[model samples]
Target: MAKQVAKTNAVRLIEQQKIPYELLSYQVEEGQPVDGISASEKIGYSYEYVYKTLVTTVGKSQYYVFVVPVAKELDLKKAAKVVGQKKIEMIAVKELLGVTGYVRGGCSPIGMKKLFPTYIDESAETLDFMIFSAGKVGMSLKLAPHDLVKACKGNFADIVS
Candidate 1:
């Protein structure tokens, strides 16, 4: 039998929206670097299905969120264009907890302190489902990209480079 993981803010929000999702858990080996590719392998998901949530800021005061495959980088220019901002920069690691209420490796687009404008890579729009962090390290959620977009009030854009 498998142990049940506690619900996270992301899961709670999904439940509130009455959207379905599958939860996956994996071990985080001590002292080893954990990244999207390793997370996909650990969670038994394809690279294309595994997405990572990134929090970025526009200029000084505005913030935005983006989701992209772990293997790809966010195209800053496209991101700025899609979000209608002059410039966007990844939020510093030190500010993750305070800004988004999540750590770097466990950030989720859902249940953010504020619903910052979010964009998912257009590549995921064609897929049936995508996987992303469940607002916690060592855990992931699998759900339809449409459902996620609705739940997060986000849209799809060509934000990946």
Candidate 2:
């Protein structure tokens, strides 16, 4: 089931953009996984090049998506300001699942239930490319930052602390 979901998202993105990407698979043990951190090491990619997907709520009326390197933490104040909101808080795992239609470790910027507004940490811009979960744990996709921004309609923000 997990494989099917990831495949669907990958296919959708491919058909949508017709862009080139590499699918990376790694051994991922379930049950309390370390998520993005574990994935970075397992896939032999530097943590700096791997972005973690985070869900957050703003002003009690808006939900936003955040993509940041695991090496940094989400700075809510900075993120809120970037989005023109005064307050922001992390979304619960259940709400995140409902919003993204993907489990905690697998939630991705693409293939979400709704096309929530997205922001990628400014640090990502420094990289030639970045990697993120391909809608499942144990799988990831490698692509250019500009392509990500295009595919996600992502806005750049200094949302990492």
Candidate 3:
């Protein structure tokens, strides 16, 4: 059974893997200011290089993880095909927090509630490194895409829409 992890899953993930990682913390405002585009700017990084964690459902399945770029949305059809499913839809924002044990904007791919199938957009590999949430709001982790795949046990493909 999957463990009901604490609030610091991401950090624990790094420790578990014995891999070095740097947590990038930023001040998040009270309200929704900007989406991925502005988040990249706020963090002084490129939009494409920063990845977002999405919880998507295939048919009646609860959810699986999808890591996509901030500049592009998940192409549901492509994502489904890649994951060997007929259809997939993004889960509601509220549901994301529940399943991943992190808020919508702060869902980290590593140390999730369960080891659901994970897909990383192919574009993310083009860069040397990418940034993702640290299992907490306002914290991000910087690491190599290849290392991330090994660390998170994730697969890479062209699943972006």
Q: Give each prediction's root-mean-square deviation over alpha carbons.
A: 1.1, 2.8, 5.3
Candidates by lDDT, descending order: 1, 2, 3
lDDT measured at residue 5 in model 1 versus the true structure, 0 to 100: 83
Give me the candidate number with maximum lDDT. 1
Q: Give the lDDT of residue 4 in candidate 1.
A: 71
Q: What is the lDDT of candidate 1?
A: 0.92
* Rank order (by TM-score, best first): 1, 2, 3
- TM-score winner between candidates 1 and 2: 1
Clash pairs, candidate 1, are none
Candidate 3 lDDT over 1-161, as tens digits, reads: 96443447888878788887777767788876446667677788877778888889865555778899888888999988887888888888767766778887788899888888888999988788899888777778888898789877889999876
User: What residue pairs clash in candidate 3, if any at all?
Assistant: 75-161
lDDT of each: 0.92, 0.82, 0.81
The worst-scoring run of ten residues by lDDT in candidate 2 lies at 2-11
Q: lDDT tens digits, residues 10-63, model 1?
A: 999999999999989999977766899999999887888999999999666799
